[model samples]
Target: MSESIDIVYEALGRYIDGLCGSTYIGTARGMVVLYRGAEIHHLTPLKEPLPFLNLFYRKGTVEIVGVWREEKSEAFFLRAAAADVRLFEDERTISIITYPRTGDMQERGMLIITLHANMGMAKTLKSIIQEETRFIKKEEVVISSRVSI
Candidate 1:
């Protein structure tokens, strides 16, 4: 069964695209990774300025966060938007880059996922994130009244 475990990753690709359906699968280390095709953004340095001159460290994890739409758990209620979901990170050192979370946090924090994947896989992931980052206008209307003297 271990030798055939490759299906897990394959399922993940399809799952993100809605082709895999509801049942979720965890990684070898007991964690499930997910993404929203409509909420990713390519953050510029203005928001996350490259603080200091790097002497050695270079590679970093790709960060993402949103309403969790995953397995059932207690953390679901913590998310302000949807009571049914919450975001989290696994202990996989090579895959996720997480930082300390603090205070009365309602929103699920970043995922810091990896982009150092195969070209096809990386592109698929990138596309999902990119599509969501596109700007779409929303219309708003305001009402006003005039007073007669």
Candidate 2:
């Protein structure tokens, strides 16, 4: 496998060593899993890169939601769902700022992992999103700085 592939897989799979799916039945699905939990996460891509993202706050963003559970089935990463994957920072957890294609927002429109899981879960989801985003997005450098004496 390519080094980048190894790098990404290793980084994401760091926590999977203790989780489920350690058995060897195969089932035709891939053996590697990054983070598996009760929550079902949705993933999307950014067509255009964001202008800037501060490093300290940008770590631990998840890109691919979950692993493919079956062989012939491909994990569908939604491109159009970009609009629904907005991030809203809360006191502890980052709420997935989702919206329907039409109509108004309702009680059934949002999702959160709770405060205790802010980093454990929310950060993983965010990290997956960020990593995949970085892999696909071209690097762009912005210059210009002001000097104050």
Best by lDDT: 2
Clashes of each: 0, 11
Candidate 1 lDDT tens digits, 12-106: 33334322232211211112122223443221111222211101100111212111122211010000111111222233222432321322243
Each model's TM-score, in the order given? 0.23, 0.25
**Per-residue lDDT for 16-100 in model 2, tens only?**
4313322111111111111113433322111222111111111222222222222222222111132234555555544444332
Scored against the true structure, residue 146 in model 2 reaches a CA lDDT of: 11
Q: List lDDT for all candidates, in order.
A: 0.22, 0.27
TM-score, model 1 to reference: 0.23
Model 1 bad stretches (over 4 Å) = 1-19, 22-103, 106-109, 134-149
Candidate 2 global lDDT:
0.27
Off by over 4 Å in 2: 1-83, 102-116, 133-149
